[model samples]
Target: MTGTPRRFLVTATPPTTNGDLHVGHLSGPYLGADVFSRAQRMLGHTALYASGGDDHQTYVVTTAQRLGVDPVELAARCNREITGTLELADIDIDAFTRPDDVYRDEVREFFAGLYSAGRLVRRTWTFPYCAETDRYLLEAFATGYCPECLVGTCGAICENCGHPNDAGSLLFAESAGAQEGSTTEPRDVEILVLPLEEYREQFTEFYRRRRATMRPHVLRFVDEMLSRPLPDFPVSYPAHWGIPVGIEGFDGQVINVWAEMLPGLRHMAEAARVRRSPRTPAGVWAADSGFELVQFLGYDNTFYFSFAHLGLALAHGGLVEPTAIVTNEFYHLNGSKFSTSRRHLIWARDLVGKYGPDNVRFHLGLSNPEHQPADFTEAGFLETVRTRLHEPLQALATALAPHTGQPVTVRPETEALLDRYRDRMRRAYTLETFSVRQATETTANLLALLAARAAGDPGLAVAGLRVLGAQAAPLVPGLAAVIESRYAAATPGTVPELADLLPVTV
Candidate 1:
């Protein structure tokens, strides 16, 4: 282990207050951040994991209206559901602050400060107005019939026809689920804009520097953003649904989610400071904080999370900058994007209800979609549960249980094997590389080796099992107790050879 552990600020926004979290949510930044935070704690580091419910978006208000309840009540109900779901999945968030409640003033200051400094500008742009919502549609809701292929779908671009259309170019639906009887409307609204053009050269340099210093996938994203046409749209909306802009003239307007949402990062930074121990490292609060801020998110949020938000946060704030933005591409389910509307996604509740949190945790670690789109199939779920969680760990526990019959000597080779596992885990957790496949592969190889070792040599196998049973005891205390009770009276398995499990890679 390293001499001293590094402090971390791990932050992610909870799913929309109106939406239920699915497997995609589990496998995305939230899961990744949870794994990273847990690993940091395991390594004896101070890691602050902060998350908050997003209750200010138009979707939340519209969803609430459809249910014939106030948006605040609906947001509260959904927040409760979200908290329950995450807790059941063992997502132990250190702090769960609601954006609308605890972070509103912070977000307001963020907007006003930027605007007063001339960093924020205003512009007019066309947006899709939903009669049902009585508000303009955000990018997430706007969809149309494909003028090319004529397939009406629920995406900014048509999936069936593969064509792109603006709100005026196609027939508008009242709600996302709006049928033929759905109401439609178009309204022009004035919105405040964040002028990214002024910072083009600065962003180019910042992004290029980030690309040069970061992992390859992160670098690729930097290159993509640098080459894309700059978005010159208003960062604030004339709608009453989001965090209100504090500018004197923009009372009714709310800072759009993109520009306003990143204040959540700073809120977490301050919260971490408040939560940190007195002896905590000074860099955690230093103006030029050396600690990296790694943001995890899905591919759909790449533009905002990967580039735009990072740039905005760095440009607007003074404390810490986003060092590594670790965004996964996506976790697709059933050959399509995991959608709450389509019911194609697996909710965390269902999985947690069936098995347990630890089991689900193992699956999340094994199936992290850090790179390209990864599939989450029922077969994959069953296989991971059986092989990775149930069978292998159970086998190790059983093999080690009987070895404690006496004060057994710790074998040097066995200790070395445990050290190897520790080192691999440390690397995977802190190295912050984009190669999750490699991490899982290494974990698999180690587990397979342990299983084979348990099957083979008596003395070394027993000692190895004992060490694993010891190390994992703290993390999974219940499983540890079970292992100690059952295996302490038993004996090690007798396979012909020990070399089968402990292979020399060199």
Candidate 2:
């Protein structure tokens, strides 16, 4: 364990409330953040993992319309489903917040402060207007080829190249809700925009300090974005389905959902703090709070978390910027990206229900898509669980079944082995080079080694099992709990009872 303990307010990118979470979603920020936070706690630190449903995204409005339901009702239901799915997947989020009156007030105050400080500028921008839908084609309401990569993509951000496209900037833009061949006409309107070019120097200095630690792919994306003139990020949009901007001369506009992200995170953090300590006042986001911010997100959201959000925090005085940003690549299913619109994915709840949470978490962790796109196949998952986890665990249990209730003293050799494994885990869980896949592999290797020595050196095996239980707690929490309970008396350097054998299956 580290000699000094640190405090961390770890956050995952909030999932949009348009639909239920899928395995692809769980495999990215949610699972990664949970494991990282848990590992930090294991190292004797204070790590509060928090996130919530993105209830104000345009996707929610479009999905509600498609389903013939009220937008508020749909968002609420989806939020509940998302919270339940996270719980089922064993993601222990401290605060799963929903957009309430308090949230809205906080977001409004944050935006108003930025505007008053001259960080935001009012300008006339052109946006595509769909006559058929009688709405401006922005965000989820629009679809076109990205301006940079020329890949077919939705508005706002391109998942392929990690670039942002302003409304009406997408090539061959068309209304997503309109009939085939339906086109949108350009309409100019006054709105608030953040000219990112103005803060180029600040962003450059910030990224210069982070170059060594940030992921290569993420750094490449940032460098590519900084190579050109930064685009104007719209802060407000003309709409009626979201939180109203409430700024003068923008009566009909609402705050852009992307722009609301940083403030929303602050709100969630404050909420978490209040729950942890009732007397603690708000403003835990202050830079002097001593809580290092660590953000976990996917490659598609690198721009928002690393750049856009950083700009917002800097512009807002006294707010803390993220100290570390962890990103994962796309997790695919059957060689294709999981898409709710295409309905080509496995629901997280279904998998957890069928295979159990620990089994599912173990598979996802072993195959975590950290650097490149990783595919999820049922056959591959089943094979990994059977060979890598279940078989070895069962073998060890069988060999030690006869030794149940027997007392054994841990050996010096066992301490050295445990120390080596602990070192591996410390490396794997390091914030700068964190890897769930590596951590999972270390746990599996320890289990295999223990299984091999179960019969010959039962004392060493039991002691090693104790080490494995503690090490695996962060990755496979449910399994670790079971292991610890069964081997409760198998403490290192002491003669203790083995109690009972491991479960037949996990």
User: Backbone clashes in each candidate structure, one number apiece?
Assistant: 8, 0
Q: What lDDT is reached at residue 361 by model 1?
A: 54
State the lDDT at 21 in candidate 1: 84
Task: List TM-score per model, in order.
Answer: 0.81, 0.96
Report the Cα lDDT for residue 82, model 1.
83
What is the alpha-carbon lDDT for the whole of candidate 2?
0.85
Clash pairs, candidate 1, are 192-234, 192-235, 193-234, 193-235, 401-487, 401-488, 402-487, 402-490
Error of 2 at 49 (Å): 1.1
Q: Give the winner by lDDT.
A: 2
Relative to the true structure, candidate 2 reaches a TM of 0.96
Mind giving the per-residue lDDT tens digits that candidate 2 earns over 82-127?
9999999889888889889999999999999999999999999888
**lDDT, each prediction:** 0.62, 0.85
Worst 10 residues of 2 by lDDT: 495-504
